[model samples]
Target: MEERKARTVCCIGDVHGYISKLQSLWSNLESCIPRLDFDSALIIFLGDYCDRGPDTRLVIDFLVSLPFRYPRQKHVFLSGNHDFAFAAFLGAIPQPQDGSEFREGWKEYEMSEEREGWYREEGYQGMHLQGRRWAGKITVRFNTIKGTEYQGSIYDAEPTFKSYGVPHGSSDLLRAVPEEHKKFLTDLVWVHEEDNVCIETSDGVKTGRLIAVHAGLQKGKKVEEQLSSLKAKDTRIPKVEALSGRKSVWDIPEELTEPPTIVVSGHHGKLHIDGLRLIIDEGGGLENNPVAAIILPGLKIVRDTDPLVKQ
Candidate 1:
């Protein structure tokens, strides 16, 4: 019996609206991998597709065109914290099944509303907390942690508004965003699971289940419960921990250890690979950093600034 070739799987990190970097990285991936393999590869995009950079509109357009451009390739788009807020502001998130108002979820973060300048414009009455925050104006101009000047809001979402031809905090953004872009945001998944995924290791090639989320799964929680909440897109919770958590979600859940699942994510703003766990967000949406991607089986790392392709 002829042995089947292992399929190529590429997991791309946070783009944060840098169209040029994304284009360069895509070209580099093409140049580095064989054409036949690249065409049929499974491409998983770890989100944060909007904000921070100036080309969000173009970036979304590029992502939307991928399926048509590369018909043979399979693509999976996961929602990141930034993207979740973006979708919230666009009213793209599905309403809670319980029928509670989105504003009801704002109680926990209400204290920060005044300081963050949460959006209270024309259509803010029923807005989600993250949506208001995303479109809000912050009094402070600098971010101590990121060491970058605030781009109109704490989410640094001013660039996203500008990319759509609207001024920051303006309700005009409600209409400025295109329908296709809105659909793309609405369709983003919070969690993606793949069975029998092949990955390279020091020992050898191994096949196992793969779980891809934005930030990561919390370490101590029940994997099934967390997966349920994410799959339901429960907007009742003020914040989706898996998409925005920091240290809490840095490790894989103990439950998946028995079966040896590969957990991958891209929201930590750094590249880390340990055993079957991978964190691929090397760019962190900073102007100076380059976007990154990880090719499975071979476990090869590719960056936008690699200079692998000819100019």
Candidate 2:
């Protein structure tokens, strides 16, 4: 048997679609960690690679090229809610197990479809709820404390569609996105687990298991059941709570009493560092914020705008 070496896990939060910010963040990560460790690091991107910003296409390109560029580093590309919707729009999402067509998931959300302004363009009649939702128009307005209007919908996926040279809600996006990029989107995992990882806490440094998902595990659901569904990539079930729910996924499930898994996520659009649960999405799909990451062992944070980079 091969002995496994301790890996430096670098968990990156949501990178909406800002390639420049991602590039700068990558540079900062490289600068902070030793070159050898960085080269062999286990990089976990906490999903949401598409939507909200410019250059979604470029962001996917960069993610797809990482394995080839850094052969030794292990990369985990998780499927964020946005990426899932993007994949659904391209007809790349996995099918439901009940032999139901992808369109079945759209029925429940149909009443809101008109209100949400779901994509009714070419081939949309056969798409999933997430696909339509991904391309839907904004039904409500968002404003910052300064009263500046946030320039997108709840999904904020228009930029993603436009980034691929297709208008929002257009089936032309099916061909607009490159094949490899589509594969990347389709291959994203719903959950990732790493055992024997070192975690930093007030108690002391200890080795524990870690789980990374886009949003989080549903509070009342069983961990194994949730893991089983996620592992199977079940799409038949309408409304994946892990991908979209907020308050429901906020608390860790009480049933996981065995080894106590440390859960981390990013879709909340906020940076929350709670005891064992860490939500690191600081960008919040905003134009002014920087992409962020939390390095393992010490849980040291490094952002795109880290002082090391003279930005």
Candidate 3:
């Protein structure tokens, strides 16, 4: 009997609308890996495809074309927090299953509305809180956290707006965004899982189940409960911690350890690899940073700014 070969999996980090970097990284990946492996590879893009940098429109176009361009490669696009808010503003997210209005979600964060300058434009009535905040203008000029000027809104979505040929905070963006682009945003998944994935550890290569989320699973929560909500794309909860959390979601759940599950994420703005946990967002959408990707089995990292190709 012959043993089956391991499949190659490539997990890409946050793009943040950098078209050139994404293109370079894509080229680099193809150049680094063997042609057959690259063609049939499972490419998982940990999301944040828009905002911060310029060329979001082009980035979406490139992503949308991947299926047609490489029919053999498997592609999985996970929704980032920025994308969720983008979809919300575009009225792309589905209505809550419980028959509650999207406005109901605003109450929890309503105190910050005025301060955040929540969008009260043409269609704010039925919009979600994140949508309002995404399109809203901020009162402050500087973003203390990122150490940069606030880019039109709290989400730094000015570039996204401009990419569609609209001015910052203009309600005209509703009509400006193309239908395909809207579809791309609407079709984004909250979470994805793969079985029998091979990961390289310092000790040796290990096979396990892998869970890819935009942020990560909370440390103490039941994995099933969290996955249920994520799978349902539950919008009732104002903030999906799994999609946009900080330290609380830094670690993998204890239950997953028994089965040797690998937890990977990209919303934390840093590259962290400890044992089976991988957080691969080196770019964080910053202009100076380079977009990154991690190739499985070998656990090698490929970046947009890498010199030419690997030796």
Candidate 4:
């Protein structure tokens, strides 16, 4: 019989469209996977795949194509605020066009690559997914106008995807997402349905302890310990609240307002807060926001440049 190999799940946090940073992290991952001889693996790519960086579409394409290369593992996508916006843009919802413009505004990363046989002007690349594409591929030419901004062009008339959330607009993104990734966003972004704190032993059980979440749970408030007190889904950390029955991360006022649970989220680049939380957005990529992920190879929870690696 073939050897039964153990599996590992790497729960990654916000990537923010940093292609270079992702490359560097992947370089490191190459060694981590084999050295341990771990079985199968899953990369939970916490979302916000676009914006604030250079190669937005490149990142999206790369993530979408992951399963092709590694048929043995799964690449899960979690919806962050930005990704949700991009999804809305794709569906033609009337949100801000700045994000769409930003994409339409830039050139593709491969545009400059010598491999491409064409030499089109950087300004030539067209909009994708309804004006959503890459920032690096083109430049933002801002022109303010009284009638409709940007020399009355209907394109600039729209606003960038609002950083903030709107009901119908936000949901649109989730609605039209690719089939496989749809559940990841729904599972994370929407509210949960939990009455008491419940710790679900992932299929492997070991991955459960990793407690990989887009944002860490309240500090000192181990999901295992505070399972019962968790009232809503929004504030609860990813895993604990996932199994719990809550509506959305927005549902829990206690977690969001006052006693906000300590989180290990990637939003705050250099996590600045109180309580027993740790920030894993370790300033990844050069000139790019850091890319952070937790590698649970066996019983250890490992991270990039993280002193928290279990000994």
Candidate 5:
């Protein structure tokens, strides 16, 4: 059998709409990795591309432009919870399976609709759960574990709206995001699988499987069941645990007994690395922190501030 060449897989954590920082990070990544490896790298952006920061529109534009500029590199875009809401606000979320109406799932979350400020604007009767949550208003102020203060709502999507020249709850938001960008948001994947990647162990280099979701997989749920729901792009469920649930997705599923798949994610807002589970969102969409990424095989970490750092 022909030997499989060693390749690099780059996983980027939550971007949160910082154009300059993202650009800087990209420059650093390009500078650090060899040209051939950089060109052929499998780059997976772990989601949360919009919100919090001041350049959501520009960030999306840059993301959408990746394929054209780096044609040889493979890119996988995952859907972050905030990005899901942004899509919902723009009516770009994936449709329910089987062509069923989205409203069928509304009753489950209806109680919090008022609190979350589900869309009261025109054409809201046809909205989906994410659409409602994305457009909903709330009085809650969120303070992160690191003491970052987020005022107004959970998703903190106001900056995204403003980046596109609209207010947080304006109906004009649907018209604000460009058609290509809306398509970009709608096309985001819920999960990605990479087979036969190499990982370095204490003893030796070994082949491994990798599954990347925006958030970690639920601890107790059947792995197939979770993957089924995610692959189906089911929106009827009130919350997609893979996208937003924190504690639920923190651990690897116990039933994944054989083959030893590596589960990686972002959206937890904290960096965690334990054996096969990697959470890489160091920036956590915070203004002061640097966005981060993890290089495969060697498990090297690169940040927006210290891009050349490697193992």
Candidate 6:
């Protein structure tokens, strides 16, 4: 049976460890609350919990403690690709040379059925992200003569992950991640695709649908069909005619042959679709960008909110 959910839900977007920002949001929410009363409330954290900001570790520590600290509160922390890699490193999977930060994030949150169960009910296998397989084709790839790629040849996979830039190449920071975590990350890069959350929410006085995602859905196919295409385990490159039925996250042919259901994604940071009512990603980890989140279970009745993380 699908687990029962609280009537009121608060959806948080990509929080790239902006400790101060998080604190600010938390404090503000207190004031934001008391404006309504429901049988219960669920606070859903749309993934992308770390990276691109200062104190990624600190941010994770704070977030992981919420469940235990709050008790009985309806909370769901979805796993972002980065969250998986960092947590795996902490658990020492695919063991990396350094596992300190990953360890910190891992230890920060308890691995409970409650946490994993949250996403399972959501119908996203993000929790098993570490177990996702990529034998056929890879959307993104990496080729650098850096630490891992000794062969030094062009290799294709997903983008691997985002580079925070500012203090690029933090060997100490990178190395702190355990080997297993590195492998998980490597695998994640090999199969990066458009990932997002589909939520159901309601505004104050009306009912509506909304999608909060990191990128926009391909123009051609409907959102539901496009989602089915992504769910494919055998992502074989479709023939041109067959491709007509598929959908891509970002970087799809602008001239879409099919129009899928609407997707609200955040990967490109800010892109939109009309029919889908695609909302732009409030830039996180980007300079001068406002931290953001999407509230749900209100009256507007949003269907999903997906936080996009780079491969």
- RMSD per candidate (Å) reads 2.0, 3.0, 2.0, 14.6, 2.7, 14.7
TM-score for candidate 3: 0.97
CA displacement after TM-score superposition, residue 40 of candidate 6 (Å): 3.3
lDDT of 5 by residue, 25-142 (tens): 8888887889999999999999999988999999999999999999999999999999887887677876776777778878887787766666678667777777777766765555
TM-score of each: 0.97, 0.92, 0.97, 0.44, 0.93, 0.45
Q: Per-residue CA lDDT of candidate 1, range 188-280, in tens? A: 999999876888777678788899999999987889999999998998887989999999999888888887899999999999999888999
Error of 4 at 262 (Å): 12
How many angstroms is residue 122 displaced in model 4 relative to the true structure, after the best TM-score fit? 24
Off by over 4 Å in 1: 1-5
Q: What local lDDT score does residue 125 receive in model 1, on the 0 to 100 scale?
A: 92
Summarize candidate 6's per-residue lDDT along 1-311 as a digit string, tens digits.
11233245555656665677676666555444454421235565545555555656566567766767666565655444345434432332333324322223323233432322111222123222221211012222332322232111011111222222212222233445445434333332111222122233231222223333333445566645654543331122211112111235553334332332223333334433343344434653454565555444332322112222212
Question: Candidate 6 regions off by >4 Å?
Answer: 1-6, 35-39, 79-264, 271-280, 297-311
lDDT of each: 0.92, 0.83, 0.92, 0.39, 0.83, 0.38
> How does candidate 5 fare on TM-score?
0.93
> Any idea what lDDT model 5 has?
0.83
lDDT of 1: 0.92
